[model samples]
Target: MNKPPRKKNPTFGIAIFIVVAVLLVIATLFYNAITEKREFDRQNAPEPTISSDAAAAAATTAKPASGAAQ
Candidate 1:
């Protein structure tokens, strides 16, 4: 029987690998840049304030949800 042709060159796979690696590097750098900017903004932000009554309400509702999950 005649043998069908298979992938003879590994260059295509190597090129794909290089492209993916470059894309990943770009993504990592972009993510890091955004996080650094966010950190800077967070540090400069003013202290947040919330009502004690609302906080207590949230805390009370949280316990029953946890118990019901059991």
Candidate 2:
């Protein structure tokens, strides 16, 4: 069995490497844009943000009312 002659071009490998690198950079940018858009939408969604201090104060004040009712 005779194998086909291989083409000898050292630059061919470099060309392929450059193409792959560009593709990877484009893919990364695309992925980052999509993730950022999703995050932006999530921030704009109708979810309420509560502070930890306000939550703790509410819990402490409610405890005495519940105990008095019992």
Task: Give the number of the best model, judged by TM-score.
Answer: 1
- lDDT of candidates 1 onward, in order: 0.87, 0.88
For residues 1-70, write the lDDT of model 1, one tens digit per residue: 9989886799999999999999999999999999999999999997655786678778778455555856
| Angstrom error at residue 56, model 1 | 23
Q: List model 2 lDDT by residue over 1-70, tens digit each.
A: 9999998999999999999999999999999999999999988887555686678778778355555856
Estimate the TM-score of every prediction: 0.56, 0.54
Backbone clashes for every candidate come to 0, 0
* Candidate 1 clashes between residue pairs 3 or more apart in a chain or in different chains: none
**Which pairs clash (backbone N, Cα, C closer than 3 Å) in model 2?**
none
lDDT of 1 at 26: 100
RMSD of 2: 6.4
Q: How accurate is candidate 2 locally (lDDT)?
A: 0.88
Alpha-carbon RMSD of each model: 10.0, 6.4
Against the true structure, candidate 1 has what lDDT? 0.87
Model 1: how large is the Cα RMSD against the reference?
Answer: 10.0
